[model samples]
Target: MTAGEALAAAAARLRAAGVDSPARDARILLAHAASVDAARITLIAPEDLSPDIEERFVNLVSLRAVRVPVSHLIGEREFYGRRFKVSRDVLDPRPETETLIETALAAPFGSVLDLGTGSGCILVTLLAERPQAVGTGVDISEAACLQASANAVLHGVEARADLRKSDWFDGVEGRFDLIVSNPPYLSADEMQNVQPELQQHEPRIALTDEADGLSVYRIIARDAARFLSPGGRVMVEIGWTQAQDVCAIFDAAGWQTIRVLQDLGGKDRVIQAQMAEIGN
Candidate 1:
């Protein structure tokens, strides 16, 4: 089969499977199978495909046909203009989460902690961007910690970042100037409504709180004060409708100066709060 032939077959299969933008996905996968860029796929799509290349393309199509996330199939995901390794054990990084990084960067901090730091996208990116910063990323899955560590090395920040396996704050110590997270906040119903690629491919523990969707926030809100220094800040990525509820959690936890920021879509997506001092 030629590249064009492979593309046609993959597109047809993806479309039948109800995957959006079948042609676009087909082109990307084809490029990967052919060892070329997506843009270059267009130029040589009519060219003949080797038997080995055709076999690889077929395997990728099979994976995508079953609703596996394209990023997982590709083995890497781009976040904040950098690529991070991803696995079934970690949540794939999304563009919206990059907003969390930008928000954290806006405030100057020497040390950072990334809670629920699946794939290390936020922590690694933060350490990469802020040279003087040292950070640690904590995740429940050991596999995720390994992947995050590998990505830290890939991004040339391994010396400044530590990846560890912990159930939230269980194994973590020391206070940080800034703490951030993109925790699982999707409600059960929300999980059901998620796209198949995400629902089937991504780790459930990294996507939903497995309860009413407030579990992670509750834990983070209550524990953050202990882990953050006086005047330290915490930023969390939240579901659009979750801003007020999350803010209330922080307030109840005694965190002050609670503020929510909106993403590009005008939805309140990040809630930032400062831990108050004892005297004040």
Candidate 2:
């Protein structure tokens, strides 16, 4: 089949399987299978697919039809203009989390920490941006640490990145000028309502707190002070409706000047909290 015919057939299959954005997913997977940039997919649409490309595209579409994330199938996801290697072992790097990167880059910092650093997207990106800065990324899962480590190597940030398997701040040492996270924020009920790409395919540990979904925010708010340098800041990604609750958690913990920043879509997507310098 020609590229156009193959894309139509794949999109129809994905649509029947309830995949959202069927045409887009089909086109992206086709580009991956054909070993070309997705931007060039349209340019090549009228061309005939090579036999090997056609076979690979068919397999990839089948997996996507079952709701496997395109990033998982393609082995990487772009965040903040950089592609980070991704896998089923770690949460796929998402566009929404890029808001946290933008917030973190608003200031200069000598050191950084990323808690629950699945895939190390935040920490790696920060260190890559601020080349002189060093960063430590901690995740509870060793597999996630491995995945992040690979991305650090892929992006040449491994020299400045320290990857560890730690639960939140446990066993982490040293103070940092910045700390960031995109922790699990979905409640059990909310998890049930998530798309299959999240509920069935993404790691459960990266999706929900399994309780109220605000558990990790409380931990960060309460303990981050101990690890933050004077004037240090903490930023986190939260659910759209979580601004009030997350701000309360930080406020109750004595954090200073809690601010909510919205994503490009104009929803509350990041919580930026500052730590008071010694004595005020």
Candidate 3:
């Protein structure tokens, strides 16, 4: 069949399977299968698709219909204007997490620490944005560290970025002017309600801590002060309804300047706080 015909058939199959944004997903997957830019898809003639391209497109559509994330199917995701390789090994970088990057960049820092660094999107982006800065990213999964390392190299910041296999601060050393995380914050109950794409395809350890979702924040709050330089700040992405609880965790840990920042959607997305200067 032709390219347009194949696209229409795939979109119809996706729509019938109850996939949201079926047409958009189909277009993107088709472009990927056909090895063309998504923008170039519209310019191609209906008869441009070869048999192999048509077969690949049909297989991709079938996988997407089963609720697999398009990013996983494509093996990369765009974050902060750059593409990072993604897989089941790391959480897919979401647009909401960009709020953490924006908040971190608003302040001055010579060094950074990214906990649960997943795909290394946050650490690599920061280092790329600030050429003089160096950063460390740690994850519990070795595969995640590998993925993050690859992304750092892809962004040409591998020299300034260190990816480590650690559970939070376990193997991390040195103080940083800024520490950030988008740890698993979903409660067990919330985990039960997530979309199948995330629930089944994404890493569960990166989605929920199997507790109240505040456990990871509590751990960060209790230990971050020890690893932060004088006047160093900590910023973390949180669940929309978690602003108060997370702020309280940091406040109780003696962090000052605790504040919540909202995303473009006006939902609480980041909680930031600073350590007291050494003299104080």
Candidate 4:
């Protein structure tokens, strides 16, 4: 069948299965199944699709109808204007985490440490954008570490990025000019009601700390001073409601210059703090 005919059929199937934006999703899925860009779909309308490609598109539409996330199906996601491979093993990169990168770049830092760097989006983007900066990304999951390393290579920052396997700071052994993390901070109750797409598809370990949602922050706040050069800063992505509690953690850790930056949605989503003085 022609590409346009396939899109129409896919759209009807999606609508029948209760998927929203059926037409749009159909177009994207069809293009992807054909191994072509979505824009190419419009230009190549009324063209023949191989039997195998048509069958693959039909299968994808069925999956989308069941609410499987498109990123999972596509095996990659675009973040910060670059595409990063993704999987069920990592949390899909969120836009709010870019605030961590922005705040880090603005700070007085030449090197960075990204703890719990799942897909290496923040670390890779930073190294790609800042020619002089080098960074290390640590993750507890070996799979995540490998994925982050792959992203580093994909973005031409492999030489500047060190991907390590560790839980938090357990295996890390040095100081950093800046430390950042978007660690799991979702509380148990919150996870129970998270978006179906997230809860059903994204890795649970990447979404929650499996304890009080703030465990990762507490660990980072308590130990970051040891890894941070004097006056070196740390930026962490937190849950929208976590600003106060996270600030308290930093305060108790003796960090000063604590600041919370909001995302485009005006939600306080990133916390920045500096290590304390020796005498303090």
- TM-score of each model, in listed order: 0.94, 0.97, 0.97, 0.91
In candidate 4, the residue pairs with backbone N, CA or C atoms under 3 Å apart (3 or more residues apart, or in different chains) clash, namely none
lDDT of 2 at 212: 97
| Angstrom error at residue 94, model 4 | 1.9
Give per-residue CA lDDT, model 3, range 187-270, as digits (tens): 999998898899999999999999999999999988888889988889999999999999999888878789899999999999
lDDT of 1 by residue, 1-280 (tens): 7788889989999999999999988888888888888889878977899998899889999988888888887899889999899989899888888778888989799999999888999999999899999998999988889989999999999999978889999989998999899999999888988998778878898989778898999998888878887788889999999988999988888876998898878889899988557222
Residue 134 lDDT (model 3): 97
Q: Which order, best to worst by lDDT?
A: 2, 3, 1, 4
With a 3 Å backbone cut-off (N, CA, C), the pairs that clash in candidate 2 are none
| Worst-scoring 10-residue span by lDDT in model 3 | 271-280
User: Better model by TM-score, 2 or 4?
Assistant: 2
Q: Tens digit of lDDT per residue, candidate 2, span 106-205? A: 9999999999998999999999999999999999999999999999999999999999999999969989999899999999999888998988878999
Instruction: Give the total clashing residue pairs for model 2.
Output: 0
Candidate 4, superposed: residue stretches over 4 Å from native = 12-24, 276-280
Measured by TM-score, how close is model 1 to the native structure? 0.94
| Alpha-carbon RMSD, each predicted model | 1.7, 1.4, 1.4, 2.2
